[model samples]
Target chain A: MTTGTASARTRLDPARRRTQLLDLGVGLLATRTLDELTIDLLAERAGISRGLLYHYFGGKHAFHEAVVRRAVEDLVAQTAPPAGGEPLERLLASMTSYVDYVTANYEGYASIVRAAQGGHEALRRLHEQARNVLTDRIFTEDAQGAVIPDTPATRLAVRGWSAMTEELVLTWAADPGPVTRDQLLAAVTGSLPALVDLLR
Target chain B: MTTGTASARTRLDPARRRTQLLDLGVGLLATRTLDELTIDLLAERAGISRGLLYHYFGGKHAFHEAVVRRAVEDLVAQTAPPAGGEPLERLLASMTSYVDYVTANYEGYASIVRAAQGGHEALRRLHEQARNVLTDRIFTEDAQGAVIPDTPATRLAVRGWSAMTEELVLTWAADPGPVTRDQLLAAVTGSLPALVDLLR
Candidate 1:
């Protein structure tokens, strides 16, 4: 019985080790570029056997994808609009939420962003998910006359507005300067009326 | 006399070797992530001895920085505002120029963008140089607007506008939809007066 218990403990150790490896790999990704990350380096950092590392993740690409997926989920969760605000207010709140998310989790956010450059299907899905949320907010806002638009114009307007919000969040993350959260929120809000009219 | 001739060839070789290394490194960077970029690989790609590579670039960081700086200068040169046009026309023309530049050279542009996240001082300087050019255009357009106040609000407005423009360009490059060049130009032009008002 004692011998059997010893074997079970040994088996469970590897599974625990694998989980630890995934966590470390994902955590490091936030701070380092994808290309800079190496399996040997990751194994060393995670205190795992390189052979076992391969068993757990298959390879670096798979590991990186997992990290990216988590970031996408996090970003979507962080920026989801409030339930009962006016359309414009909801949009503004969502934009500010995104900025705050970027500021606080820049490492993870940046990694996912860099990984998304390629036509990675998972990343694309994540992007489309975010776009859909923004689109809903824009449509609601437009219906309220907070954002003016016909279909084509409104679609273009939201696209442009999102384009700006995404870019500013990225820039502020890259360099935290006098461009405060308040500044970015105001700037995005300021553009909404023009965005609505442009759509019309 | 033979020794002297050999010395002259050796002296000339270093600069030629450095240029060759930069060419190879830059070419790879256009398509690959910085983490994937390695000195051993770069030396092999350049067909130079590792010793010669060190002699030219000092190390990987310096080499990466130089490649980034070269890419930035090229982008700035390509997208510099057209020599003369109306403020709105000039803005649209510059956006068109930007679209052309990125479409033609996105790999290099993407690489520079990746480098920006590192937030190295040199990278920050490159970003500032690019921003200054865009800011100048914003100022030019805003000058004609009698109502737009030249205050902190105006600065934030211009910065936000530029951020949006940059974001849309990057996104379009990543995913070119039905919004053709003419359509994009018209939408942006239609929205300009509202953008001007938001600053005021």
Candidate 2:
């Protein structure tokens, strides 16, 4: 049985094994902060030796970077706007998706976002890249940027609004207070256009 | 000559020496990140041997906690709203002070906020306490909470506004682009009340 189990784990190629380990790590993030996800715990969860996990990730630091990058990629992909909709509808759809995404992945997402705030350079860069994709979606929604006006002040508003939206959503997801998801969504959805209107 | 130098270095009592070391660390934060403020570097700048510095601080981790605490206190003090003013004027005054404080202490301020996000527990608590103070000031500006009714929705908006303001100020301080400080201040100052108004 031991031989069979070892072979079952080793059946996958190196690339496949790395992917599997990362996926498990990401899954764990739903319940655990990265700091708390020690190598021993991960290895035990995966039913693999600690040495094997290290072999795949080299070390905790490298493993964490990989996990965060993967999480960011998932976040960016999930938050991507729809293929067809009016500007307002598209924006609402995007916002709703964001609220839902973070709602479902609050622990993982918050930790990643919060960690990026820390001095983690690699994570910060990854986070900034994800943020750019999110912010850039606003401009791309209207090719000429006419609706939003891609000037510095508008850009600043959008960036600021992004921060507001993220903060609100995270707070809402965590405790939600008296606010329902719909109410939360409406407020978040309304605020972006309201902020941009002020710039105009 | 050696004895004179040694005595001069030790001139301050231990408590005073500790404060001076912490103050020096905080000052360094204006230009360098806490991560970059190593004991070796601090000791060199303070003209104290690394051993003496270690004796005072115990370790780097404890030293960082003390520095972050002091920085947060300074930030809170600088951002306290005026004792008397119209709610709107007081809010604006507080916002402007916040912008100016961050402008002067951008590196230190950013690092601390960022580190708080990074899952540094003590730093995160300090950051949260600072955030609470900033948000709570919104309510205290009017004794009745008349201008800004302190509801869950309003509280959420205030918290969100704080995030937006922090992000905008930090970004503006780092790279104003075409946005002037006054313009940035106006946008930030205007946004908070506008956000609260929406909740109404």
Candidate 3:
């Protein structure tokens, strides 16, 4: 029986094992901050040895970067705007989706925010990528149309608007009662026209 | 002569010693992140014994909190609006001071910004205090006068605006001249009236 169990574990493909580990990481992030994550604890939880975990991630920092990157990718996927709508309608849809994603995945949102502020190089790159994608969607093209010409000022405005949206969503997620989701969505999207005007 | 040197070091008052240690920390922050700071390095830089440094700060975390608090206080003082001006003028003056402070003290600004994102409890509190003071000045009363009523929405707007301002200043500090300081200042303050309008 012991030999059979060992053989089954060893037979797990590397890709499958990696995915399993990453899924465990995502689950753990729901309850723990990235800073609090440890390889030993994860290994124990997975019923594997620390050596096996390190074989997959090399170290805690590497594992953390992977987790952060995955989270950011997930966020981008979750918030992607649907096809074929008016620009304003698309913008509003995107904003609502963003708030919904944040509220539903508070831990992932928190992790991304925390990592964006002077985290490791990979994590920071992932953060910038996420921001750029959102900015591109909002400024370069939207469902309604290409609303703004891509200029330096437009880029700055988009980035600023992105930052504002993030801060508002984070605040709302932490305490939902103070402001309803609709109010939060309205506040964020309503401010965009003014932001575009300022950029112009 | 050795005894004399030792005696002179020991003769430094506790208040003076604490100040000396904190000043070293401030200097180190110019080149290192707060998490990178160490008592051993500080003691060596200050030509004090490790025990003496520990005497002033029980641990590295405590020392970091003290340094962050001091930096935040210094930032508040540096950015305080000059007394008795129109609200718009006062707001602009305050914004200019903020930009100047951030440009001159990039490291400190970075540290404060980083700390505001999931740092120690004390550092986070100090950051909120700094933000509150700035937000209050902007929303409650200035030379121009109280432009917005103090409501939940108003508070949210002020906070969102503050975060936007911080992100802009930090970006400008990293690479100046793409947007002139005046442009950055104008961008931030110009967006505020609109934000207030949106909130209303």
Candidate 4:
């Protein structure tokens, strides 16, 4: 009876357990760098043994990769353009949504950027995927709705635009003044026409 | 006699010794992040005692700050415009020189970028100083010697341009294909007029 009670208390469905662990990781990332995140600490926080944590994540690197992949995916989902509007308006809406998301999730944004800098191939690939999705959205669907032909030069220019937006947004989120959010939003959105022209 | 030999071997003029230590630190940064860098390794490599390393740098954090500041200063010096050319030509030349410097000193640039991401106030300030210098050169001196008033919006745009250049350059350096150096350089240089237009 005692053994059955302990087992019932400890058991969690696999999907729910995974979500629980990821939520814990995302929360911890608010205050700590990936390097500072340790399995021991994570396990302790989750009230699980180290072995149990490893059973779920395999190791810290994998866990980090998972966290980063999920973060990027969440960012993409959050910034996805709303359906049915003029392409330009949708682009602005997406950019506005991105700024809002970053402002709201400064820690998460910083963590993802830090992870991208970490020289891990897995993390770099995840970052690239996010960039590619954003670029495709801008170039394929949002640049006046006629799909722009993709070339190396166009790709590079699109990436440049994305990078500029990311850097400016991150800077603004970190500091939050000097340039008001409206000004920042306008500057980024205004740059889009120039970016499109450059690609052309 | 042994004591005299030991003292002679160990003694270095303070300026010379500081340069030597900085050089060592820079070289080490080529392979290791500041977090991975340790006083013990630096001391061992420099053939000095840990106490002596501290005597010069107080501790690891200060040492990292000094290293990052010097690196940024060196980057600024290396990219400083050459004397007396057409403003546009000099801008292109400066861009060329910057690409050359970053490609040549990839590790140093990575170290500076990593330091910027480290959430250290000193590092972020040093990064801002570097960005300001580059922005001033581009807006005040290089853009046809027309002094653009540095409003917050203008400042943000200039910094955005700078950040775009950096991210693209860093990405090109790391990947080095699909876009040739000439193409990358031209793409970045071509965007300058548009950036200027946006700021206007």
Candidate 5:
């Protein structure tokens, strides 16, 4: 960063600086896994010091959580089903956005996955919260008032679908090999209805 | 206590002692997560000293890997598709065995999944090796020769299917909720052919 941005860090109000730090953290997640992101690195990247970084988020883990939460919120928004549409069309659209967003933010998405699978409590909650949002959209009916019954069994199937989508999207994004984007999306979205139908 | 099993730890040969240690580790996984199975706990359970534990496996990580490898090997064998049958029947049988094995070995299965997602290199490799063993079986032909052609696309689909199965099986096993065992099994097995059929 130029001296202009670096030295101007202290000029911002406390809340703005915190948000700035988190935004910088999210940006770093573009290239770094959550595990690799240390407070020292964030401090250096932001042209600030470690003590000041801790002053904002209190600790490294908390800072990681805040950045992860922001990224997941963006992802949840990106993949939300449209307000009005046929259910299947909305699902397909959502899946398309999901694949596009994850591919674009491959490293961040991967970091979130790793954090969730790790022993981190806050990240685990964020990961599940993000997932539940996406899974809820699969059954949420804007005008029709829920076409799928939203029972425990159906919920289980939907969670499975989410897992399937995550795995395929990440694996394909990393190395799509012979699998085209369209085919991948088709396989992911195509199997959901089939899976839910079995529950019914 | 009779003290027979506890004292015998010092009497066994090295190979037998290593196997005994590994087997004890596997048994502990029945009730505890891989994360929870500390070297201290294993040493205490085996009625042996931590120094001896390190002597056998060199360190805690290596010990965990060996124990996990043994557990995953058992899972791989348990879920192996039967040698001969109609494709769908063999698939169903495999799914049944898959669910049965995971439910029985729920803690170990969860640990393997968590370890695979975590940064642990060896466990991740073992997890993939076990998964590949299972996924490859989906295409392996015992007598009629390979049937699925095993393209990159199909392999991707199968991997996604495996992810789906893992999520569903783990979720369902934790709490079947209103879903019956048969329903869970069907939801998992029924979707595979549909997913594969989409490729054709």
Candidate 6:
């Protein structure tokens, strides 16, 4: 029953179908609020039977959780701390990577945030898992790697930076045109040395 | 027909009625999803006539917006830095106030956040207005009081602090028990000396 394009038809393998569903879901999420996203419409738009969606995810909540997990995983991978550099330099590099990731995948990022706000319990778990991993990475890899002592001061520094990064990115996502990616990166890097000193 | 004890009877005034309705909205918001808050239910539990609610707010959306605005304004007011204090001290004080405000009004804050996420344009406007006021207060009042010069670095320092405060409060509101309010306040204060150096 596909009526539009050739690429839309033959790309119906299970992997492709799953990707297609996520893509459709992400697109819908951008223009419409999450409350309105329904399984029937997601399946209809993806050119897949409703049964197939259930086959893959068992339910819409599961599908949503899967989508959120993938998004968070991608974000974490993109912002993973750099190795073999000076601590401050590596931390700066990671912040640059993080800004780039959020700017590029702003929609997916926003969707995960919205889900974290009030989505299903599974989405909350996925969000928490991603946060825990990222926070741990910052503590062990970024802040500690810089030779910053593991004192309470350093811990506070890391938490402050982490908090600001999320806040700035969230605002940027809401209105990207006003706050460019460069400004965001500069904001993070510009504040890093001061953050590093807290560890000392 | 008014009913119940002295505490309930005291809320029959127009201003208190509005407050009661909004508080009830916040209460309902925590238990049920935002999409479920309706005028009839709000009015019924509020023990106020539907006509009176409409008179106070024009409609459900207006009432919701007012409630969000009131909560945000309260937060902004409470978090504003006190005059005649050192920049760092004032910043710490502001952070403590913010943490306390969010912790005390977790559900009300969540309701506003949920309403904003729902693409409620009026609520978004109110939220942004409160944020801009906070940002401006930090720059004009708090940052102006800093011993450091008002350079770009100083501005960015304020920005970093502002971002951290907002993000920490938002995360805290979403999940209150994991991070204690004192821990968050201490974390920000501990990072301040380093952050101030960056600004200078």
Top candidate on DockQ is 5
CAPRI quality of model 4: acceptable
Candidate 5: tens digits of C-alpha lDDT, residues B63-86: 889998898787777777777777
Q: Write the per-residue lDDT of candidate 5 for residues A109-155, one digit (tens) a residue.
A: 88789768756778888898888877776666533534466777778
Winning candidate number (lDDT): 2
Question: How far out, in Å, is residue B164 in model 4?
Answer: 0.8
Against the true two-chain complex, what DockQ does each candidate achieve? 0.17, 0.52, 0.35, 0.25, 0.62, 0.20
Candidate ranking under DockQ, highest first, comes to 5, 2, 3, 4, 6, 1
**Tens digits of per-residue lDDT for model 1, A8-103:** 545666567666666676667666765666788787886657877778778777766655665566667777778876666877887788888777
- lDDT per residue (tens digit) for residues B1-200 in model 6: 55777766665787877776777776665555455667777878877678877898897777777766666766777888877767768877887887777666665565666556435667767866776787667667644455444555454555556667665566656665544566666655665444555435
Better of 1 and 3 by DockQ: 3
Quote the positional error of residue B196 for candidate 5 in Å.
1.8
Error of 6 at A19 (Å): 5.7
Interface RMSDs of the predictions, in order, are 5.1, 1.7, 2.3, 3.4, 1.5, 5.5
lDDT of 2 by residue, A30-113 (tens): 777778778898899998799998888889888899988888777778877898878777777888889988888888788778
TM for candidate 5 is 0.88
Candidate 1 C-alpha RMSD relative to the actual structure: 8.3
Candidate 3 chain A — worst ten consecutive residues by lDDT sum? A139-148
Q: Write the per-residue lDDT of candidate 4 for residues A1-200, one digit (tens) a residue.
A: 33585686577577788887887887776566676668898889988899988888898889888777767777788888888887667777888999998877677667677567544658767887888888888766744534345666666667778888888888778887667787777778777666655555
TM-score of every prediction relative to native:
0.57, 0.85, 0.79, 0.69, 0.88, 0.64
What is the iRMSD of the candidate numbered 6? 5.5
Stretches off by above 4 angstroms in model 4 are A1-12, A20-68, A82-87, A118-128, A136-148, A174-183, A190-193, A196-200, B1-12, B20-69, B82-90, B119-128, B136-147, B175-183, B190-193, B196-200
Q: Write the per-residue lDDT of candidate 3 for residues B1-200, one digit (tens) a residue.
A: 32686786778678977887787788777667676678888888888788877778888788888887777777778778777777777778888988887777787668767766653567767788888888877755642336666777767877788888888778768876456777788878788877777765
Candidate 3: chain B TM-score equals 0.86
DockQ of 2: 0.52
> What's the TM for model 3?
0.79
Fraction of native Cα contacts reproduced by each candidate: 0.27, 0.61, 0.37, 0.34, 0.70, 0.24
Docking class of 2: medium
Model 2 quality (TM-score): 0.85
**Per-residue accuracy of model 1 over B25-100 as CA lDDT, tens digit each:** 7677766666566788887886657877776778877777777666666666666666666666766776677777
